[model samples]
Target chain A: MRGGAIAILAWATVLLVLFIGNWIWDAKPVNAATAAFAAVVTYATGVALWLARREALRPGPPAPRSEPESVPQSSLAAVLIGLSVGTILFGLAWANFLVYFGAGILVLSLGRLVLELRSERATRRRLLGEEEPR
Target chain B: MSVATAPRARLARRGGWPEALTSTDHKQIGLNLGACSLFFFLLGGVFALILRTQLAQSNMQVLSDNSYNEIFTMHGSTMIYLFVTPMAVAMATYLVPLQIGAVRLSAPRLSLAGFWTWLAGGLVMESSWLTADGAGRTGWSSYVPMSNSTNTPGVGQDLWVIGVILVALGLTAMSICVTVTVARRRAPGMALLRMPVFTWTALLSVLMIVAAFPMLILAMTLLFIDRTGAGHIYTGFAGAIDYQDLFWFFGHPVVYVMFFPYLGGAAEAVAVNAHKRWFGYTAFVVSIMMFSALSMAVWSHHMYTTGGVTNQYFAFTSTLLLVPAGIEYFDMIGTLIGGAIVLRASMLFALTFFLQFLVGGLSGVFVASPVLDYHAYGTYIVVAHFHYTLFAGSIFGFFAAAYHWFPKLTGALLREGLGKLQLAVMVIGTNLTFFPMFFLGNDGMPRRVSRYPTHPEWGTLNLLETIGAGIIALGVLIFLINVIVSLRRRIVAGDDPWLGHTLEWATTSPPPPLNFEAPLPPVRSYAPLLDLREQQLDRERRLEGAPA
Candidate 1:
């Protein structure tokens, strides 16, 4: 929607001001670093949104859409990827062999995730083609 | 022009656990996350009961010191990381898209992955109990020096550190999805400001989560490395103070992360039951932004006694928070005045949330002052203060949401009578359990102790608190029973039960996979359904007045 980037940017500016105040008052390196990092991350997100669409910074509701949107029903690859990461971390604390096993799963899941994305794009294309007036 | 939905082709429509676990639908993901959070809530409650039992009388020896330490740490950790914060996210994930008339979340697959990762983190954290030593005993904050490799060395603590990292990582990923959805997925007319009250609150919450949670991940990851002797990353006095700074940076905003969504839910419940649009909508939105921003800046208030930070700066920021806090209360009161107020269970809980949170907020102001905090810190007063806020306040708001949205979530109305009874019992139990701690804390009783030397007043109050904890448990049990009985009886809730004001009510109860099956009502205002009703009423009035 319009102004989404503006809102984020505005809030990030407020955080930056607060962080500046913190730096001036406390001057502790760790505290300053933490505040600075948060501010930067927020500002970076705002900038990314702005760059994605200039309209995101303008003020109004979004325009009505005509494009078809793909909605995936299920993503087993996503679940597997999540479990793999968790398993890899858990293995670090518990066992070494499990880490290798989780890595293998992660690789397979990534491949499946690519397949899902390609399929989703094809579904969107099909929907668009069906709607094209012959 | 209407938005068009593309059909799924290749994905198999499987049922049972596979579908439940792998579904990328925001609603399903939300429900899965919420169910897990509720389970953690009961788990956390059991931990609370154990703590209360141990503290019932001085030198009771209900559990050994080490065991007590583990229980208390897990109690705080489970409730914050697993229950309250995740519940807020679950509510937002499930309802924000529906409320804003979005078809689905941005990055749905990522959100699903986040859910699984978070669940695994919780399991890993709890699995610490099965270890040779025990679960984490260094408290939820897990400061350095005290939590260093030499002092509190164990695999359990290591697992806790890793678990916290995963939880933070997962929550961050999910929060990013919510944030992106809000920014990009609004219905045609649902502008940034015109998004419903709950969506605004949820937006702020996810933003805060995105801005703050990474610090926790960094803090935990470094703690793990420090614990494993990879590096003396946190060393000496500076290390301790640095760790606190890092932890509380995430820590303080998290309190609001646990709060804002529930507050939004309660606000919606109040407005709907009162049969009025939310009061001072622009002011309310602005205040929450200020409130959340101030919350991030005030983290060092927790470190005031440590003498490593500027007390005045933090205190000033913390005190400034009262301004926004006051605005919200004023808006709530303004909304209630001269409206068609209904004393539904949800409405009562909403009112109770405001009242109980006032107690917590006022107490917070006291501790926000360095002079006052010098006396209150590490005492039962601090414990009482936060419990009033987090438990009495946020949990009550959560219930308000539950009661208001239960129909929408499940297509069944929860038994009102049982709900009212549960509310009554919970209120009494909550007050009884937490109120006495203020008195006990003022009398110089320190917190985090398994045993204390016997004094009549302390003993009696602790006993009262233990009994109150039991009563609270009973109240929760009543609620569970109410849920079961209501679901079984199946009091079918129609599409627009309670004449709800938002876009979500325009759809069927337990909404379709795409959220809305019908074209969304024109979002001329935040409450599109209310706008439609008012327009209809105006038309009827004009026709009646005309000289036909």
Candidate 2:
């Protein structure tokens, strides 16, 4: 992750320059506001990365690593959540009953997602415990 | 490199449909996204052929005017949203992790969700054709005032808006994952500058997506609200201009989003086939950064004729794009100079991509001028310009990627003979189909019209374009056949078939679940494998000089 923050910040700076130019020359509220919002989002992303890891702002390659982490093989809940959102939006354009149906599925999927995540965390914990010295 | 094994033990293993549907593997997600995008590409191509048939001759009644409008709208929408944009993301999702030596994507489950959401959006959009009102008849841009309920009223139009919102949301979600992955997931020694050319391009594309796609989602959502009578958001002249500004902000960047990744693909193909590292690697990187940033500032150029934008500012930014574009061409030439050149299918496609995109770029310079744009604004010249860039340029580059990577993806070689044939036919068909439009537009033929008056050369040119469309379809058929034949015959491609420079080639063909089964080669440079090869050559020379 070394230099990650710098890259994002550099891009954000470019956007900021363009945003200022737009603000001065075009001066349309929507145009200026859109440009500003984009710059803010990019800056926020860079700042968040920097805050997460101070080394993200440092220049160089990352240190080599050997770390154990859980990788999910599959997740049905994720697919359901996505479909439910699409359904709710489509229902707004097509039928009212589908909205309720989609909302029901969304709640169920969220619950299922929580359970899946909990199970993944447990698995990770078990692996780490096994790796510890006796 | 260690992964928790307990999760596999805890979760039941499934295969076939269930596994394909629910797998969190980035490779699977990328494949699913790509296969669906290909299907949509074919669907959009059919729509294009239908339009071509209707315009084959003056006053041809192949389709009703309304039908023509719907087909044209769907054609642009399907190609842009469902095919090209997502395909770029699909390539990044699959290849970026492999290129950067990551074990997996940053958020696999979220990427799967994104895939499903995008597919659902595509389905919903296409389902509009089944509605009683036919389909969304407005152009893909669907400018406000005209797209309002009074002028264009129907469930189909509303459905189009909703579909667009969903697609934008899905693409944005997926793009965020890629951005985060690049930020957090590179292997040790794979510094930002040491990342592969394609990975850099993908990073810029996803960054643009994260920055611009929300504006699109917001625009579409407000349009839907306005259509549903919730509010009159776009009510005045200023509102109309506001809508255009917002749309073009996304619209213009999306063009580069579609181009940059394909450009990277073509660049890689060229470097590999030439037996040389990419020339001007650092300059190429800086140029694309400038290229991408200028892409954002040039959005207002699309609105120049509207008279509500600062034309001079936009025109200047739009024209400034040529500097970086010229640098890329120069880099390509530098790479080609005095290198061991191979005339492989992928190399040919890469060369064609550069040659054809030049025409598009030069035409862009002409149209970037406000004075010149006033003449070419709504004509077929604009149509020709974009087709050269998007279809002729990007599609050629896409084929270059496919031919170059099919072996790595499938552990098999595509039929080179068939590939060459397809490339030649496509090149002919593409130029024949789009090149004449420049002349037709110069003669004042407008776009989005189903028929034109019988002029001396208009009928002949339209006839040639229609024939060219068929030829392009034939070329695509040749490609499909090549894929089927190659996959079935099964000429096994081992790891590092092309002696590739990137990390993806350092592993098994098609890769394992974790991408690399063996330890990664030390990533000392962007082209680590190339460095290894050169070191071995130097060692052999030393041994020969020792007189052993």
Candidate 1 vs. true structure, TM-score:
0.96
lDDT of 1 by residue, B71-155 (tens): 9999999999999999999999999999988989999999999999999899999999999989999999998888877988788
Give the alpha carbon lDDT tens digit for every residue of B238-299 in model 2: 88999999999999999999999999999999999999999999899888988988898889
Off by over 4 Å in 1: A49-65, B1-14, B546-548
Docking level of model 2? medium
Q: List the residue pairs that clash in candidate 1.
A: none
- Could you tell me how far off, in angstroms, the CA of residue B205 lies in candidate 1 after the best superposition? 0.9
Which candidate ranks first by lDDT, i.e. highest?
Answer: 1
Evaluated at residue B39, the lDDT of candidate 1 is 100
True contacts kept of each: 0.60, 0.60
